[model samples]
Target: MSTTTSETGARVVPIPPPLYYAAALVGGVLLDRVFPLAAAHPALRVAGLVIACAGAGSAAAGVLAVIRHRTTIVPHRPVATLITTGVYRVSRNPMYLGLALLVPGLGLLIGTWWPLVLLPLTLLAVTRLVIAPEERYLRQRFPDEYDAYRARVRRWL
Candidate 1:
């Protein structure tokens, strides 16, 4: 979903995180096609697959936790609850963290360096374009509760 202003229902997250990650993955793969930087070993590629799976699992767990709580998963949307259980207990932004990990893993799995190379930019974009705004909204909306949660949980782990 697109970001909305404070006056509208949802507010401040500039873009959906999935879109950022997807673009990174696709762009990186395309860059790999042009640059041709293949992984050096077969084991590394396998490792990438494992990492990708783990990332997928983590992201899925986060999504499930949100669904179980019956809250909106959309970053821009107004949150109904402060999710501090399940996947959220470990990281405040598990879904983003998962996708962040996933993009690089996919790059390695594909035997290329571009995704890993592009990962930093992906993170920068996600943090600035999505997470930062969402955090602002959360802190503004939940104040004391969000502060407590932030105090205890790491942003990413």
Candidate 2:
């Protein structure tokens, strides 16, 4: 399924989260490769690895929650239920948050400043191009339940 603006008929980006993560990872790698920088301290590299692992864990938890709830994990697909437990209790967009966290973690691991610089831009793109549309759809579909959930949980933690 595709997302489109009713008023302008403009197409909303339907890029999947994995693709976004890949793009950000590739962009950061390329930037670092072209302009090599001093490697981060070993401690920092370890910290980055931990953060990346945490992100992957979080994303997995989110997916598991969705599965347990019998809902589609695909953002563009129809949501079967409003999930508010587990990771969803803390962050409305844990998967997106996970992907966002990976940027800095990977950057730090690679000892490149470029990924840190591009983090905000990557987040902005995900927020505007992906999360916003999903939020709109969820609000429309779940209405009251979603409103309550939104009130209780932060978008990202």
Q: Local distance difference test, per candidate? A: 0.83, 0.78
Which ranges of candidate 1 are over 4 A from the true structure? 1-10
Write out the backbone clash pairs for model 2.
Answer: none
Poorest lDDT segment (10 consecutive residues) of candidate 2 = 3-12
Q: Pick the candidate with the highest lDDT.
A: 1
TM-scores of all predicted structures: 0.90, 0.88
lDDT of 2 by residue, 6-120 (tens): 2221124867766777677788789778887545799879878988888887888888898899877777677778899999989998887887777778877988767767777
- Candidate 2 lDDT at 4 equals 36
lDDT of 1 by residue, 1-157 (tens): 7544332333445666798889888998888778888886999888898889989988999999989988888876667788999889999998988998899889888888788888899899878777777788888777898999999999988
| Candidate 1 colliding pairs | none
